[model samples]
Target chain A: MADVAYLPGLPRMLPALLPADDNSSPWRFPQYFADHFSEVMGWLWAHTWLSVVPVIAGLIIALPIGWLASRHKWAYPPMMTVSGLLYTIPSIALFVLVPPLLGLDPLSPLQVPIALTVYSVALLVRVVADGLGSVSEETLQAATAIGYTPVGRFFTVELPIAVPVITAGLRVAVVANVSIVAVAGTIGMVNLGLLFDQGFKLSTDTPYYPPIVLGLLLCVLLALVLDLLVILLGRMLTPWRKAVRS
Target chain B: MIGNVLRWLNDPDNWNGTQFTTGIWAQLQTHLLYSVIAVLAALVIGLPLGLAIGHTGRATSLISGLNAVRALPTVGVLVLLVVIIAPHFHGRTSKGYIIPTLIVLILLAVPPILSNTYAGVQNVDPAVRDAAYGMGMTGPQVLWRVELPNSLPLIFSGLRSATLQVIATATIAAYVTLGGLGRFIYDGLAQQDYPQMISGGVLVAALALIADLVLALVQRYTVSRGLTKRFSKSTVGGAVAADLEEAGVEHT
Candidate 1:
């Protein structure tokens, strides 16, 4: 039902609004621009690692932080506030500061991923905190009365209740962080951002357009695709999302 | 550790400068001004557009597009825009960068406020709409008089959240070589002054925390108070929602 809301020709609008300016037609994108699909694929290949690694690292940290935050009432809020504070610090400053204390090259690939992971930590911590927090105290008390051990109660009781919120939070954080990693490319060991920077420097003749557009497209697609997965995950993981079996 | 932090917080002058330093107050004032301008700009653009989208059929498309934009890498965007736009503004001195920095910060602010307002308006009770209609109210009249007032509580939460975020993030504007507390952060790091860098970093972090707390209080006091004016909204919502259910009809 919701799918019908999307405009049928919505995908075509961007090109219509900003006509393709490729006079050089280096790729010779033939009868249909999609004919240059190989180029898009190539571009995707170049940046896929940068996008994926940071998101993966963010997830690994956020899941536990979210879980811990959700379980403890007092623990969740203060830490979340702290994390929120951490979330606001500009990435550039944070990166610059790290090299001084950690001896890590500020521009290193490891540095970007590490910085991105820290950013993701704030998001995940908040999400897990909120998700677990929403498990009604009534349900929690009921679980305790039934003799579920603290750990047993977490896995069996609280976690199930929190899954939907946690999944949604993870989805949002992933989308936000992946884009950040792309920015990391601007100053990293290897990144598509470097391509955009290169393209900008070279002007229209730059190898930038195809890669920049393709990279942006990839980023947008990842966001949309991941969002759908999160929706599906939510539906599968939570009773609330699924329609009652008639 | 706590004592060290306390020592920093305790001395009134320490807030603006630690021992015998001036310009701490100036830096603090500049940071506050930049954040305030950015947040206000975002609110101005976001609130009205959000109201329009929230109440219309076009909402889903607009909000999704905005979300996509919101997910954009802030640093990357700055870098990209700086290439095209920053050059025009570049001056022999730092002041030239201020306008572009504000413009970009404003761009960052829009999504949170817009999304929050949309969500707030969306959550407003449909029964309230019906009641306004029942009173022979026109659409805009109903929207402004009934829907917006009712949506205030949630809408304020969005603004609070967004503004707090803007305050934390506006520090990034310092990267353009403009002056703010962020300038301190960059300078501290470049000079390898941990105490000064940490001090600036810690202060900015504290500002964000304080902003979050203050806004949460604001959301509660102002937005909720605004809702009390429409005291019957919830009750009307319940009555109408129940009635609609009985009719085997519900509209999202």
Candidate 2:
């Protein structure tokens, strides 16, 4: 209600004012940027691969499981519950939990991607199931009526129609993975998180802003770029939706 | 390994701290305190904005923008914030780690709460809104009386997800040298105490599940029976799915 004393306007204004304060901080921009430029880029590349591979792997693994859940009514609840439980496990815990389970070194690069794949699969499984379920019964029936086998109908009809929804889930998976992969850095994995750790340790005596600020900017940039790519892909695959709109 | 963890958890020395200052109990309190405060802060910021956006059908882009904030690595954000903000509070006790940790948790919590609330209120039937208007209700009145009650289920679902996320992320607060159950995990990792680390993980998982269960019960009880029946399970699922989709879009 309007009567409620809420300052909804404040949040919208905070971001604009925040950067101005950065100028007064101890860290100088061009100098700091120049100092850490190459190192920052290296970490960014590591972060990108660590975040991205899991999503691709997760999507591949989730497809069959998602398809099975969508095909069988009774499978949905158990699938969602298991994945949901998987998701609730803390990222750091899973990051640590995996190396022991897989008998890998604690700092193994494989650990982060594997842990992230588990998360992406957890997130994407439900997304895949829901996306497949979103297909209209009549449309599916029509496909079957045209003499399509179950596999043929799924590949030819269901999968194409499900692209938007699946892509939507993929975007979430990718972004979430990016954030999570940074956690691995805290435990000594070389990634963008190394930047954060560097910044944190350096700031122990003074608030050194460059590595932290650069890492933040790069992570946000990566997320935005990946998000845009997914949206673009979604639009390309669902050309009929655009045609219908016109 | 499981037996070793159980033994570590049950050890008398593990529970030996003063009333609320040490041991598993104190760590649990620290974890809960961080999560609760962050979630409360998120609700304060997110709920009204979501309701306004839902009612007015405006600033929808804002919701998507907020959703992208969720994608920022929490660990990165936490450390960044600590590096930037911790020095300002350098002389103060506890403020250093607490401030940045709270900021990260609140940031994580806000998106889900905001998005779900917006979706819930917007999804309310237009006919119902028009009917309320026909009865001479003002915009504020209609929002408070009609939209709020109807949107309770989705709002609670958002709160549940946000709470779970905060609890999970709060475990990382210990990485910044704050006290929480994560202290055990971080300490164990540093000391190579596998049993302690595993137990910490077990405790956090248990806490998350328990908290979610409690919230689900609260959600079930608070919503009206008629509204629950009307919304139905599939509608709720659809709402959650749609919210997740929006979350996906925003993160990108």
Best by lDDT: 2
Worst lDDT run of 10 residues, candidate 1 chain B, spans B82-91
- Candidate 2 residue-wise lDDT at A56: 90
- lDDT agreement with native, every candidate: 0.64, 0.83
Model 1 lDDT, residue B198, Cα = 49
lDDT of 2 at B138: 97
Count clashes in each candidate, considering only residues at least 3 apart in sequence or on different chains: 2, 2
lDDT of 2 by residue, B129-235 (tens): 99999999999999999999989989998999999889988998888989888888888888888788777777887888889888878888899765654244468
Candidate 2: C-alpha lDDT: 0.83
lDDT of 1 at B186: 58
What would the per-residue lDDT of candidate 1 be over residues B1-252, giving only the tens digit for each residue?
A: 333434544667755565545455777788899889888888899999999988884756878787768666565455445443433332375443566567777888888788888888888878888888999999899889887888887677677767665665567655545567766665655665445554565667667767777877766666644344324446876676567656866422
Off by over 4 Å in 1: A1-121, A129-162, A182-246, B1-23, B56-60, B89-96, B132-141, B191-196, B225-252
Off by over 4 Å in 2: A1-39, A101-107, B17-21, B90-92, B135-138, B230-252
Error of 2 at B181 (Å): 1.3
